[model samples]
Target: MRTIAIGDIHGGLKALVQVLNAIEVREDDTLIFVGDYVDGWSESAQVIQFLIELSQKTNCIFIKGNHDAWCERWLRTDTVDSTWYLHGGEETMASYKDVSLADKKAHLEFLENMPFYYLDDANRLFLHAGFTSMHGVEKEAFETTLYFDRTLWEVALTLDKRIKRASAFYPKRLKHYEEIYIGHTPTTNFDSDVPMNAANVWNIDTGAAFKGKLSGIDIHTKEVFQSDHLPNLYPNEKGRNKN
Candidate 1:
């Protein structure tokens, strides 16, 4: 059984569909999602809907993203966060404008139940974002760093790959995990549009919400699959609005 980790979708339903269709998933295979399943594009509702159906097929682990938290707050309490609205929340709202009340409620329940991280038997940790070392702290801090941290990726991107290989911060930040997977920060921000690696930390968020493609990688093999640029597939919508 293959364990595949998928990056942030950011409401790119077309890209999501294409990537899922290309992959070969089995009943025993495990699927891990790093989060940010909603917002950015105008297909947030559809993206959630597809996930609902996909859940019925195999083992699916959904990690909560900051944007997912924002979406649930609005769905359950009717309180609109102005910050969310400024950062692709408007586009997400537009997608659900026509969804049925019952369906929306179901989607809310799904989002509300999402976890912040996943630790498997292989000692690999998956989170929406990895933690930053403060005074040199381990990367995983319950769910706090799992959803909000960017230091894990930041430090990895800044240092030379050789430094990571020789002296791993995995023990400091990732605890006992052999490897870690994360999303949240787009790969485009690093001026690349592919999955990146630093020591035992792997970043698969290829920025499908921006000018990059949706990415999926086999956790064990590092085999990659990608879709077209999000804007190319979604011509009418601006993938993300700068806040």
Candidate 2:
């Protein structure tokens, strides 16, 4: 019954499939996806449809992401945010051109129902981005921060290795969970194409939205599984690489 924390997928359905196959997921394994399921690659709509079906046979927990929120809003209201459009939403919109209205409504409901964060029985916290509350996620004043904040990751990255959890210098937010698993900030941004751990926070987002691979990690054993780089899988697509 291993629990795996999957990183931001960003609509790379092929990469998602590759990682899941690499994991050789068993019937009892729990898959917790730390969001950004759409926007970026060419299969945004297909990816949503796949997940919707996959959840029926597997135990899965989905966390909401900023991009997902934007896509959900567009699906519900037909209003596109310019910022979202610039950041992979254009590709997401294109992916839905052939999808039926019924499927779109179902997908919109899926996105709308996802929680901003999830806490496992082991006290492990999983979220798409980060939270700003020192008292933990429940105390977060702004729901948006859970899927939009980067300060949590930034603080974790800058913490001194010498600082013990019991020490006064350790960040209060880090102490709230047995461990924190997050996506949104790609490990590739720091030059690593694999999952990176800073303090007690594990960032599994390997930048599938750009030039990196999609990644997943076993929470207990810390075993990483990755897909071929998105560029390799999607050849002609630029993904979210503006250049």
Candidate 3:
């Protein structure tokens, strides 16, 4: 049974399907989604429904992302005044505009219960954004794992770097058991595939919200699959130079 870790979907159900098709997932395999399931695209409802159904079919680990947290806040409070509404929340809401209140409540409940981080026996940690010093069920109750910023990213990055340096310095006696798999940050920021030692804490979020490609990574093998709509989807750091 292989483990496949997919990056942020951000409501791009079409792109997700394409990646799934490319992978040929099996019932015995596990699929870990890095979060940001909603917002950006016009298929938030579809994305949520897909997640619910997928969880039942396979060993699916759903980690909450910042956008997911925002959705939760909006749902639990009935107020759309959070940062989510400002980002891609507007698009997410539009997708479910016709959904019934009952259905919306059910979806929200599902999101509320999702884990902030998932740790496997193999020592791989799956988190949406990243994990802060205050993770686990205790602190996660207040802030979703998806929303952790510098606290999580920096420490994780530092630890990752240390591990790599150690491995390069001592290949035979490698340390560190956990491989951090994170999303929220996009690969577009860097030139090469982000690899923190064997712990490929990849940021496959090619920025679908900005029309970037949707990406998925296969753990163990370290192979990556991406949507074809990469170039046309999002504008790069440099604003569009349209004619």
TM per candidate comes to: 0.91, 0.99, 0.79
Report the lDDT of model 1 for residue 18. 85
Cand. 3 Cα-lDDT: 0.68
**CA RMSD of all predictions:** 2.6, 0.6, 5.0
lDDT of 3 by residue, 20-122 (tens): 8898889898888878888776687888988788788788888888888888888788779656676777777787888888888888988988887787898
Task: Give the Cα lDDT of each candidate.
Answer: 0.85, 0.95, 0.68
How well is each residue in 128-164 modelled by candidate 1, as lDDT tens digits?
A: 9876654233343455666778877876666664554
Count of backbone clashes, every candidate in sequence = 3, 0, 3
How does model 1 score by TM-score?
A: 0.91
Candidate 3 ranges beyond 4 A from true positions: 134-146, 150-177, 191-200, 230-243
Q: Estimate candidate 2's RMSD in Å.
A: 0.6
Give model 2's TM-score versus the native structure. 0.99
Q: Give candidate 2 regions above 4 Å deviation.
A: none
Measured by lDDT, the strongest candidate is 2
lDDT tens digits, residue span 33-62, model 2:
999999999999999999999999999999
Q: Which ranges of candidate 1 are over 4 A from the true structure? A: 132-144, 160-171, 241-243
The predicted structure with the larger TM-score, 1 or 2, is 2
